[model samples]
Target: MKTGEKVVLAYSGGLDTSVIIPWLKEKYDCEIIAVCIDVGQGEETHAIKKKAISSGASKVYVEDVVEEFVTDYIYPTLKAGAIYEGKYLLGTSFARPLMAKKLVEIAHQEGANVIAHGCTGKGNDQVRFEVSIKALDPSIKIIAPWRIWEIKSREEEITYALKKGIPISITKEKIYSVDKNIWHISHEGGNLENPWNEPKPELFDMVTPPEKAPDVAEYVSIEFEKGIPVKINGEELSPVELIKKANEIASIYGVGIADIVENRLVGMKSRGVYETPGGTLLYTAHKELESLVLDKETLRFKDIVAQKYADLVYNGLWFSQLKESLDAFVDETQKVVTGVVKLKLYKGNIIIAGLSSPYSLYNEELATFGEDKIYDQKDAEGFINLFGLPLKMRAYQMKHFVENQKYNKTTVGGEQ
Candidate 1:
């Protein structure tokens, strides 16, 4: 609460962050440095900039980290096949850490000792932002307004914003907490909090309803080089462009609409709807390619690793040593994950048409039921005997034990 001290705030032109500019000034009596990282929100940054300054930010920084987000964070997660709780694709999970890291970098650059974010303490993002800041620069102080401020609800925050003369887009009636980026868009709050209520089709932004999707199926080919997506439909594209193209195509077929009521890291359960058209496509294609390239044992083991990796990401441990170690293992497995996967899309389904890789271990000739010179049918006898040896031994012992019990009972009865 020192006057003249500078605090860098992560400002997302939304109601919470827009109100934060005034809140920080009033609470700390410090100069506010509002920073907005462009992770492909598709909204006008110029408007966001003007709004921040008018709301009392001394300076505003709009950083474009879309490419970095896709290549460094999204691709790595996709390659790991990390789907949290078997449903959520972790759209908002990874975005938080990246944004928090940027906040730290900007704080250092601007010579600000304190960093502030608009994340609420009840949610996972608060942890994601704070933990990432701690990992990057432990000395930097974090000011989470939601944890300390008296504003309890969105309605209360709106009232505060109105009283402060701050410009905001949220209304009391149509308030839906949303987070958008290049990868996906997440919708929380509103009627989505109720698990029994199905997500109305109109609630979705990036995807159409499956009932409204095109009648005919669509096919697309995705190419991967060393686990990173490179091309779409035979044309090589940059990471950003590839995802953009995929998003465009998949959205048409109403792909990637997930409604999950997941357990939060803060020991609470929350429901949210995620629209990840491009991310779903990329994840599906990457998995298909890995299935072709990786051996059976390695693929199954990697699945186990994938679950742990999802946990680390969902819990906001991106900059930790364990994450780096897992990344090394994931990267090692992806060395041979080079190939193209063709998929057929109909409504909300992504069906694999074909998959091929130079390092593929699937030998069609050996796997066929017809005669094959490479695989000898006679060799199966020894293989089966060795494989079932323990089971066979146990069965033999049980049979002998039963026979001995019958013989002992007969001998005792005859003697009597």
Candidate 2:
């Protein structure tokens, strides 16, 4: 509430955050501490500090949290098999909480009482950022300029940035709001706003078009230890390296491109095209491994948990008790999920080649169609009868009621 107060801003070196730097300084007469927590934005992060300084930031912190992002955020979500709307892999959804946590840490270290983020009023990121911030440190105040600022549109924001002499990469003609991280890159806005319009070829960044992919299918083996991917094609890799390698391989095959029209947390439907080449590969391989290791009942229940977990992450409840509890259950289910899964990737198709796990529950003798089972075939008659008992009783009751109605109708007309 006071002028000249120190405020920590979540600076992405993007259009919104770049404009926010001078805007916050002009409005509050405060010192702006720009914090860009790097979760694999790649080359764009190289000049973030310099950009922040030029945009009137007193100090800048470009923290590299890629490893933490992969091991903590990405892996847990993957292990739970959480996918939003049965399609989205939740690339942008889970990243916001981690960014909020980093912002709070930087704010505490700098003795700042206020935090600012460039998340627009209409989007879900505003809720994700503010809710996580409140959950972590309720006392710190939040400043969301998109909701309060006089500028009404992206055009206005661009004009303001240009007038202030802030360097930016976005232009109106080529404006597509993009969010990029190690997990995926998402494209929204621009022509993508119209659901009827198909995304142009140039809209894709990470993935090759499926039609343009090679005719030959490529085989890759992914190994998992306790549901976490450890190796690809027999090479043991660090978490970051594994994802990067997966991205490299899968992108070539046009894998992991999702065009979704999903319900936003703020009660609106939005369309986005997501490029998650590596994430798709991991999710597919991990699921195949789970199918091998997990039992019928446990797998069914875990699927229910997966939907709820996806909701929690997508709705910005990453630090909540329910999410923690779900993680515990997922971890328990993943105990026997160590295995290797071979997949054939060809032009956006992930075909399961083979799967092997140390704790596999697939009994070959029982499941085999060629005779020689450890059970008798005649036992199925009793099992089927028991399973259909309720249906049989219901059918008998309906038949009796229909016969009684016919007799009553006949007796009403004449003596029986």
Candidate 3:
């Protein structure tokens, strides 16, 4: 509704968003509130409030939502076993809706009709942020500066910010856009844009490349409660603390570096180098524990079901029923998926060191190759007989038909 005389913009104090603050101010002629949801983008957030005020924002809110981002968004995706296309952990995809939800809440609180973001038209984030806002509150108009504004490239945005004296951290010499939280740090643009180009040392944030990783292997034991990691190395911790602990541990061993040429929700190809050291270890640990406790059918079906789950979250369908239903099913599976998994982090590879669960179905006696009392040999004969009964009957009918045809031919000759 246009009744609201104010507008709230999701601000990162970056080049795009810094320019967008003033642009929205001039275009809408309304009071602009810059809402910066802090989901753990560290040092860059230092002067965001000061910068937003200087850039013509009437007010600024630098809210800390890091714990909620991890517990609510990140952990649930981990619970549902939703890994985007087997490589991506859905880093940027998961962060957007939480950001948008906060934006809508702030907008309503401030009596604002317009909610805005600096997400580019080329990527999936615009769809994610806008769709979520519409799902939550459709009345608010979305002001996307990237889609509507004349200023095209980051270079131009930086130049504009420099000329206008807007405070920003990025310069032309260092051009990688890094999005960081407890979950991951994704590097895009610059050298990563070319699909074949290998990322240089400086492109990475928290991970050492496999080749340069320590020569010795690092071992870790992670404890889980209903598929959510509860502790690292026998020490209990909260969600944020666990991730923080794992990030430190995994980074040292060169864990969780993904370079992918992925298909965007906008129907374009893009390359991004992602470092999610702790998350990579967590996923492996959870899956290892799951493989032991979860039945063959549930695990197999859930693996396939998770693709849809990933798509829903990746495409911003977190508020939908199907995702909730999948969560219900996934939650049921995780009830018995409680335990510890040991992993060997060597260079880039995460080798399964060991896995143990209270409800593990891996019965050594039942699965052993040698003769075992638990599994009677006579059971197989009955099972094979029952299983092959239909095939045996069909074969008998075909043979009998041919034999009767020969007898009939002999009988016809005798009658003639």
Q: Could you estimate the TM-score for every candidate?
A: 0.97, 0.98, 0.92
Q: How far in Å is the alpha carbon of 12 misplaced in model 1?
A: 0.1
Q: Is candidate 1 or candidate 3 better by lDDT?
A: 1
Candidate 3 lDDT tens digits, 1-416: 24336889888877788898777767767788999999987846558888888899889988899999999999889988888878899988999999999999998888787888898999888899999999899988888888888998999989988888887788888888888877899999987788888889877788887788899999999999988899899999988889999999898888999888888888988888899999999988888888899888999998988899999998888878898899898888888978889999898888999988889899999999998889888889999999999999999999999999999999999999
What does candidate 2's lDDT look like per residue over 1-416, in tens digits? 79999999999999999999999988889999999989998856558889999999999999899999999999999999999998899999999999999999999999999999999999999999999999999999999999999999888889999999999899988889999999999999999999999999999989999999999999999999999999999999999999999999999998999999999999999999999999999999999999999999999999999999999999999999999999999999999999999999999999999999989998899888988759799999999999999999999999999999999999987964
**Candidate 3 Cα errors over 4 Å, as ranges:** 1-4, 44-46, 388-416
Q: Is candidate 2 or candidate 3 better by lDDT?
A: 2
Q: Give the candidate order by descending lDDT.
A: 2, 1, 3
User: Candidate 2: what lDDT?
Assistant: 0.95
> Evaluated with lDDT, which candidate comes out highest?
2
Ordered from best to worst TM-score, the candidate numbers read 2, 1, 3
User: Which ranges in model 1 have alpha carbons more than 4 Å from their true place?
Assistant: 407-416
Reference-based lDDT, residue 376, model 2: 94
Writing each residue's lDDT as its tens digit, candidate 1 over 1-416 gives 46889999999999999998888888778999999989899879899899999999999999999999998899999999999998889988999899998999989999989999999989999999899999999999888999899999999999999999988889998888999998899999988878898987778889988899999999999989999999999999989999899999999998998888898999999998999998898899998888888888999999999999999999999999999999999999999999999999999999999998888889999899898899888898999999999999999999999999999999999999
